[model samples]
Target: MSHHLASLMVAGGLDALTYSSLAFLIASGLTVVFGMLGFLNVAHTSFYMLAGYIGFSIASRTGSFWLALLLAPPVTVALGLAAERLLFRRLYAAGHTPQLLLTIGLAYVIAETTKMIWGDDSLALAPPTGLGGHVVILGATLPVYHLFVIVITMALVGLLALLIGWTRLGMVVRAAAIHPQMVDALGFKLSAVHTFVFLVGLYLAAVAGVVMAPMLGIYPGMADDALVQSFIVVVAGGLGSLPGAFVVAGLLGLVQGFGSVFLSDYALYFPFVVLAGVLLVRPLGLFGRGGA
Candidate 1:
């Protein structure tokens, strides 16, 4: 292989990794919320977008990306909790229609509120002082912030695995996802479990938003594109399946990154094509359960 080709491949791979990292961050939360609640949170990406805007505000005022990162997720998660307590909790047994309508309305309201506060103009956020540099790998220049994203995502994946696999809360969450009535029968508060799961899921999205702010910038319509991409990931990976989300996220990222180079004219359509193919083969999704 030629040196230049190797460099190009490395660059593409890194870009794919970065994209996959972001997708997984968003989709993981969405899937978890769906898994526990048995309904998709349509406003999930709106929370993600909201976090970016909030993070930008903090960073701008405090002049510290780290501060924004530390503070933004909790703020976003608080709003999610508020929505859950006041709005979503009422719709738990109301079926998909009510849940869908409520969430979509919430999404629109959040979007409009963000525009009112931040305006429609896009805003750029610079990386932290230390992460502003780049390193050469396989003769390709790789940004340190991208590396930071990949590393942080991997760490979170490990943390999530431990949380879901070994912790009592995780066990309760899994049980609730499969058999809510039985969980309620066991003297556990099903509603509390649902609320906690939602909190964790939204926190993940908030973290993703703050982390991605530097890379993607803050904008009004950002959540819509993110929503589409993340829905594709959740559906393809199997709703509520973290491993499925992770695998499909990597695959979609590679498709987008390489497609942009090899099939530039139709690159934008490639993800939807992948989604169509997945649905044709596995209507329930690659990792989704029988009913889901």
Candidate 2:
């Protein structure tokens, strides 16, 4: 291949990696919450989109990215808590179809609420001053914002790993994931633990939104596609497996990123193809255990 062709290929590969990181960021939270709580949070993507809108609003009004970064997640956490307490708690004993229907209804409610509040116009978030330019790497120029996003995502993933592996709360979460009945038997409040897990998932989704807003341009239905994509990641990675979600998210992101270049309009369906194949081969998912 010509030197220029080689450079373009390398750049495309890096871009794919960048995209995968975003997918991982979005998917990890969904995987953790779903895996631990055994509840499919169909409204999770709304939290993601709400984060972007919240962050954008704050940043635009105050011109302080730091404030937006700090504020959005907590707001999302509160929302998650409200949903869990008011809606999800009732659905815990309900059948899967009812639980799913409730969540799906909640998703529509959130989307419509967002539209009512933010309008249908697309909104763009300005990158922080430090990440507002471009950087050249390996004879290719890439957006500094995207590089920052990749770094932040890696740090978030590492932090999540540490939280799950080292902290007391993490221990409870892990225990709940592995043996919820046992955890409750041991005197831990299952409701409290699930609430915490749900909040954490919402926070993660919010962070993903804040980071993605600059790239995706926040809009009313911004999270519609993301909801489906996250489901694909969760199922592909094996439901409830945090590490599996990361691996599958990365794979899907890479496939979509590179496939889009070649397949153009059809790239959106690439992850589904991989998902179908994986399900056929291993119905349990890449890392999902048959139970728990």
Candidate 3:
């Protein structure tokens, strides 16, 4: 009985790790954008879904996973620019409710547009040539594609940490995050910083979509659940706190991944429940310091 219990725990841990990797990929971009811009950007998940479609279309036509990976980010960046210039900028000073409404509306528009372009059917992509098998570890079989997801997510996180910690742009971003009034008083172009941050967020979302499309088939409302999940992650991790986002996202992913095995009917809500509990205990979240 003890041996069986230990094996189950090991399997659950591996599964949690896999799911956490996916969640990290999905949430990191959200964390960065929200942390920097102070906007919820509800349409973030739409970008994720769109990237999956874009990648799928490209790969299906060209049979080149590399092309899909390389092309999706730039395309999403362009879209993000347009969105910021045309829509989001207008709501920047309109207060949070208005901004939230605008973003929610944009989410619907993007979803509908995606449906018109890709139809209401589901789509999938094959893993790249090199990452299309399984490997065994600790008496458990794990998909190679998941391994790729884990590696890519960890690399991106490291790169982001370096960029934010050691680079000029990162310095500006950190300054803005810590002291927006001071940054603006110093004559920094806050608008440009916001635009750059939005673009990067969109790029990350697109990459996640492309990579995850193989595992999760793309559909019309594919981003709805993701959007909710990410919001919970953001809230639970603490608003505008990147490190907090990473921690909460990993925690939620582990709970959802493992909880599903035991409570499939309520698994999807597990993260939200955790979020609620966290909010009740520490309203500012684990990492969030009182005001941005």
Which model scores highest in lDDT? 1
Residue 48's lDDT in candidate 3 = 89
TM-score of each: 0.95, 0.93, 0.92
Give the per-residue lDDT of model 3 (tens digit) for 1-292.
7765565566666667767776767776787777776677888898888888888888888999989988986887788788889989988877778888988898999999998999998887779997888776655566788778778878877888898899999999889877888989999998887787778777777888888887877888779878877888787888667778778877886787678766779987788788988888888887877864
Displacement of residue 223 (Cα, Å) in model 2 is 1.7
- Any idea what lDDT model 1 has? 0.89
Number of clashes recorded per candidate: 0, 1, 0
- Winning candidate number (TM-score): 1
Candidate 3: residue pairs that collide: none
Summarize candidate 2's per-residue lDDT along 1-292 as a digit string, tens digits.
5876666766677678777887776777778777766677788898889889889889999998878988987887788788888899998777678888998999899898888888989999888888889877777777888778778888887887898899998898889888989999999998888888778778877988888887888988768788878888888889788778878877786777677666768987788997997888889899977863
Residues 91-156, candidate 1, lDDT per residue (tens digit)? 988988999999999999999999999999999999999999999999989899999999998888
Error of 2 at 262 (Å): 4.0
- Residue 96, model 1, lDDT: 84
